[model samples]
Target: MATPTTSTGASNKLLLAIIAIFLPPLAVALKEGLTGTFWLNLVLTLIFFIPGIIHALLVVL
Candidate 1:
């Protein structure tokens, strides 16, 4: 019961992390929506891929 839920949450985080690797803004948007964080991530992504990935991983995990 609780274990299943924990596994599901962990899998979801893994998926989000993968998505963040390719599309940081989309991953951030899925997790945090169109808030300041999302905008920041978008800007970071446009500025540089590495920074966006780091920010997205930090926010998602």
Candidate 2:
């Protein structure tokens, strides 16, 4: 018999989402590895906090 394995993707995303609530740019960077989207999120975060959180949630979750 083969042992069953569980995926951690969902839990990782949840953690990212929670991190996004506090630090949107960091979550984006972690998810995207400092890509363009991360840059955009950083800008948004710098401009406004709520939009940053929204963008992070959108990207992470």
Candidate 3:
């Protein structure tokens, strides 16, 4: 029998989303790394919206 594994892509996306909510820059850096321009921008945008806060809290905690 083989152990089942979850998809990291989905998980990472969720994690990034969470991180972006609280700390946009930090979350972007963690999720996307140096090449995560989209994530950073989204995080910044999140600052103006509710999703951003959710992302930040989830990522930080």
**Most accurate candidate by TM-score:** 1
Q: Rank candidates, lDDT, best first.
A: 1, 2, 3
Q: How does each model score on TM-score?
A: 0.93, 0.84, 0.42
Best by lDDT: 1
Model 3, range 1-61, lDDT digits (tens) per residue?
3333446665767776666655676675575566656474465565675665554545444
Whole-model lDDT, model 1: 0.97
RMSD of 1: 1.4
Candidate 1 lDDT by residue in tens digits, 1-61: 5798899999999999999999999999999999999999999999989999999999999
Model 2, residue 14: displacement in angstroms? 0.9
* Distance from true location, Cα of 7 in model 3, Å: 1.7
Could you give candidate 2's per-residue lDDT for residues 1-61 as a string of tens digits? 4333324666788899999999999999999898999999999999999999999999988
> Compared to the true structure, candidate 2 yields what TM-score?
0.84
The lDDT of model 2 is: 0.90
At residue 8, candidate 3 shows an lDDT of 61
In candidate 1, which residue pairs clash?
Answer: none
Better structure of 1 and 2 per lDDT: 1
Which has the better lDDT: candidate 1, or candidate 3?
1
